[model samples]
Target: MRISQSYIILREVRFHAFHGVMPQERKVGADFTVSLRVGVDLSLPAESDDVADTLNYATLYEVVKQQMEIPSQLLEHVAGRIGKAVMDTFPQVTGVDVTLTKLNPPMGADCAGASVELHLINDKTKV
Candidate 1:
């Protein structure tokens, strides 16, 4: 078997969501950026020129959006949820690299804000 690595990268997918330790953050919400590196085999789509042969990114966006809508106390938790959802929803997906960022954090630091990154492997990909 000729095994190779292929990835679909989704960048700067933004959402306004309630996720934090502070009450104000939960009530007012804040902007978040979600980027995903999805591991999948795209060789089929590349050959057939068919959308059905590939993982539809719009569906992946919806999955992330759904997870964001649910309130959470930590970025790590939310990111983990997103990674798991992708693995469960698409059998073709081998893994997910989730980077979730909280933009304009309530903290006084003048910075781009905080982020959590996670790499999750799909067990289904293992023999």
Candidate 2:
């Protein structure tokens, strides 16, 4: 049997502002929700009972926060960037699911929000 371990960090991230194709959007920044699911092999850590043997989630959070601060035109791009950032920052991270939600999209139609989700994995690892 195979075992999987993961954690999710879900929160609304507010930006000072400029991130969109329209001038209005750039002028009045908006609230965005960033949800991340990070997965890694925890067998070693579980067996050894050592923090050093596992990926540190606290460090991952800091990296995600830093990346969210940077403005991007498309939520898809933001999600991709965040996924890569997580993998690059944590060597132990094997896979990641990144989703970004725009609270107030410019669509005139009645809509709660728009979101995009992407999953990325480290090709080097089979986990």
Best by lDDT: 1
Q: Which lDDT value does model 1 have at 32?
A: 96
| TM-score attained by model 2 | 0.80
Among the numbered candidates, top TM-score falls to: 1
Task: Estimate TM-scores for all models.
Answer: 0.95, 0.80
lDDT per residue (tens digit) for residues 63-127 in model 1: 99999999999999999999999988898798999999999888899989799999998988862
Report, for every candidate in turn, its global Cα lDDT versus the true structure. 0.92, 0.75
List residue ranges in candidate 2 displaced over 4 A. 1-17, 47-49
- Tens-place lDDT per residue, model 2, 1-127, is 4555655454555444456777777777777777778777777777889988877767776777787778778878878888998888876677888877887788886777788999898775667
Q: Give the root-mean-square deviation of each candidate in angstroms.
A: 1.7, 2.6
Off by over 4 Å in 1: 1-3
Q: What is the TM-score (0 to 1) of candidate 1?
A: 0.95
- The local distance difference test score of model 2 is 0.75
